[model samples]
Target: MAGRVKFGVVGLDEMLHGGLLRASICAIVGTYGTGKTMFALQFAYEGLNRGEKVIYISLEEREELLRATMAQKGWDAKVFDDRFSLLRLDPTDFNLAINSIKSELPALIRSTGATRVVIDPISLFEGLFTDESIQRQEMFGFIEMMRDEDCTLVLTSETDVRDQNGSKYGLVEYLADTVILLRYIRSPGLTEVHLALEVVKMRRSPHSREIKPFEIQEDGIMVYSEASLF
Candidate 1:
C-alpha cells in the first residue's frame, strides 16, 4: 500500500497485487456501462481519503454530474474542496481540449501538488488526432511527459466496437504500464449476463490473470475475486 497506488475497489486491488506501481500509468479498457467511470472515481477518491490531492479530468461527464455521482456513493466531494479537483474538459472543442491537457495539465498538477490523476475515457483524447499515426505519436509523447511527473496516472479507454478486448484507439494498452480489461460475459442460452474483469497486462508487477465476476453496486464496484465463473 505504501509503494502502490490503490484503485480502492474492493477486490480489484487484490487482483492488482496491492495496487498499481507508484508513478506508473494504468489503463482501464472497457465498453460503455462497464463501470469505467465508477472505477475512476474510486481511484480518485482513494487518493483523497489518504489526505492526498487528486485531479480527476473527465472528458465525457460534466463536473456537476461527476460530483452527483460521488454524492450518490456517499462521498462528500465538497469536504475535500482543497484536495479534490474535478475538471470537465469539452472534448468537442479540439484546440482547447488539446491545449489544456497537453500544455496545462502538468502545470495544474504541480500547482495543486496532486499525487493521483484520473482521465475517464481517454479514447476521446485519442480521437482528437484523427490520424492513427499522429494519435500514437502524440500519446507516446503524452505518456513520457507524465512519466516526468511524480503522480500516478490512470486512464480509462473505451474498447473498440469490433473487439471488446481491444482499446478504442489500440494505443493505450501499449503505452500504459498496466491494463485492466472489463467486458460482458453471457452465460449459455443467454439467460444471464455477467460483468467480468481481468488484468490483461502489468509491466513491473505480478497480478491475477484470472477473469473474475464484478458488479456495479449502489455504492461502488465490487470484484468477486474469490468467486469463479466456471
Candidate 2:
C-alpha cells in the first residue's frame, strides 16, 4: 500500500521525502496559468514511462488542446496515447459530464489497469452541485471510488489566492491526503510566482513542511532545490 504510488516531481519528492505515497489523493491547487495542468500531465507521463498504465482525465481542456500542449513542450503525446490511454471529459452539459465521470471512472480504471490517474482541475465538477455539503459528499464518494481501485490519484483544483487560505471552493483541502499549493506571489516591481508543493498531510508517511520552488521547462514541471530565478 505504501510503495504502490510515487510522485515524479523532484522538488515535490524532496518535500515529501520521496514524493506521494501509494493509494493517496494529492491535490495541486493553483490559479490560471500556474502550470497546474502541466504538472498533472507530467505525473501521468512519468507513470507511463515507468511501464505503469496511466489514465489522464481532462475536464478543463479538450483532448486536442491537451495533446497539443504536451506536443509544444516536445513531448511525444501520441506515444503515451498509444501506450496508455487518455479519457477526455468534455460534456455538452456540465451536469451530464460530472455524472458521466462518476459513472464511468470505475470501469475506466478497471479496463485500463491504470496505476496512476489524473483528474485535471477537479473543481470543474463543482458547479454540478450547489450545496456545499452535497458537493463534499459527492467528492468524497468519487475520491473513495478511485482509492478503492488502488490507483494513485492526482486531482487539480483551481484556486484564487487573493481569497482566504487559497481555497475558494469549500473544504477541498480537508479531503485530500496531500495538498500541494502553487501560487503567484507579487513583489514590489517584479511579480514572482513560486511553486510551493506542500505535503499538507500524508497518512502514514513522513512529510516535509518546507515549501519548495519549481520551474516549468520544455520537458515539463521540475521541482527546484536551489532558489529559482525570479
Candidate 3:
C-alpha cells in the first residue's frame, strides 16, 4: 500500500493533506535562495527519523556540504550512518551522470532497502539533455521507471530562468505526481524577502492550494500554513 510520506516540514505536511502518497514522485521547483535543497534534505532526514532508510543523490552540492547542513540542523549522521546513503553525482560529465542516475540509482535503492530517495537539484540532470524532445522523452521514461520502485522520490528543480513558477526543463512538474512551488515575495518596500509556497498539484490526494508563508530556520523549514500571506 502506498501510504502517506511525511515531508518533515511543520505545516507543509498539513498543506499536503497529511503527506505525499508513498511510491510517488514529487517535484519542488524554485529559483535560487528559495530553499529547494533545504526542503529536499528535510524530506530525507524525516524519513530517517521515522526509521526508514533514505538515499540522497545530489547533482549539485557535494556530500560533505550536504552533511554539514544536516549537522547544523542537529541531525547526527553517525547515528544513522547505516540507514542513510548519500552520493554526489558530477553533473559536468554527461555520460557518467546519465549512466549513474539512469543505470545505478534503482539498483542502489534496492540494495540499500531505502524507502525514501531524493535527487536534489534534479534540474541538473534535466539540463544534461540538450535536445528538448529528447529531454521530454527521457524524463517521462525516467519518472515512469521510478514508479515501479518501492521508495518515494523527491526531485528538486530550478525554476526556468525565464519563468519563476515553472520547472527548468518543464518536464518534472508534468511527470511528477505532486508539485510544490517555492517563491520569494518581496515586501512592499523591498526591505525584506518572504518565502511562500503553494501545493500546485497533487494526484490521488487532497491538498491545500493556498500560498502560505514559510521560513528556513536553523533547525529546518517551517511552513506557516495557518498564516495568511495577505
Candidate 4:
C-alpha cells in the first residue's frame, strides 16, 4: 500500500481510511469562512510535527499573518523554522508570480527536501489565464510538475455558492487526484449556519462520502466524522 499524508485535522484522516495518498495533488474547494487556509496550515503543521519539511506558498496572506495565526493555536512557528519555508507571492503581478514559481519553486523544494506543499487559493494563479483551454493546459502541466517532485500537495480554490461542486476556475477539481469540498449549510428554518466538509472524490482510495460538520476552534480545524450534520 502506498503511504498517506495525514490531513492533520482531527477525524479527517480516518474519513479517508488513513490519509491522502503520497505524491498526490488534492484540491480543497471552499467559499469564504470555510476554514480553507486553516486546514492547509494544519496539514503543514502535521508534517512538521512528523519531522518532515513543508513549504507553504501563499497567494493571499503574508508570512507574518500565517505565523500569527499558528501562534494563536499554541504552535510556535519558530519550532519548525529550519524545516518550514513560507513563500508569499504578489498575486497582483500575475506574470512575475508565475515566472517565479516556474523558475524557483522546484529548486526551493529540492534544496529544502520538502515532503509537503500547500498552495493556498490557487484561484489567483488560475485567473492569470484568460482562456479556459489555456488555463486548463497550464494548470495540468503545473500539477504534473509538482507531482514529479514526489511530494504531497494541497491546492486550495474558491467556490461560488451556486457551484459548490466545482472550483472558481472549474478546472482544478478535474486535474486534482482528490477533491475536498467545504461549504456553509443552513439548518431547517434557516436558524443556524454550519460548516460542512465532504470528500467529493479521491482517486484509488475509498473515502467517506458523508458531509461532515467541522469547526475552527482555538487550536485548529476539527472535523466530526462520526457526528451527523442534522
What lDDT is reached at residue 169 by model 4?
A: 78
Q: What is the TM-score of each candidate against the true structure?
A: 0.98, 0.89, 0.97, 0.97
Candidate 1 ranges with C-alpha deviation above 4 Å: none
Tell me the lDDT of model 4 at 156.
93
lDDT of each: 0.93, 0.75, 0.92, 0.90
Ten residues in sequence with the least summed lDDT for candidate 2: 191-200
* Candidate 1 structure lDDT: 0.93
* Cα lDDT over the full model 4: 0.90
TM-score of decoy 4? 0.97
Alpha-carbon runs more than 4 Å astray in model 3:
none
- 1-230 in candidate 3: lDDT tens per residue? 56798999999999998999999999999999999999999999999999999999999898999999999998897799999999999999999999999999899999999999999888899889888999888898888889889999999999998999899878888889999999998888888879999999999999998999999999999999999875
What CA root-mean-square deviation does each model show from the true structure?
1.3, 2.4, 1.0, 1.2
Tell me how far the alpha carbon of residue 199 in candidate 2 is from the true structure, in angstroms, after superposition.
Answer: 3.3
User: Considering TM-score, which of the candidate structures 2 and 4 is the better prediction for this target?
Assistant: 4
Clashes in candidate 4: how many?
0
TM-score: model 2 vs. ground truth: 0.89
- Residue 191 local lDDT, model 1: 88
What would the per-residue lDDT of candidate 2 be over residues 1-230, giving only the tens digit for each residue?
75745576666677677778887888888877778898898888788778888888787788888888878877786776655677777644776688778888788888878888888878877657788889888888887777788788888888854662465685667788888777655555765545445456776778766555677887777777555434
CA shift of 43, model 3, Å = 0.4
lDDT of each residue in 123-183, candidate 4, tens digit only: 9888888888888888988987887797898999999546877898788899898999999
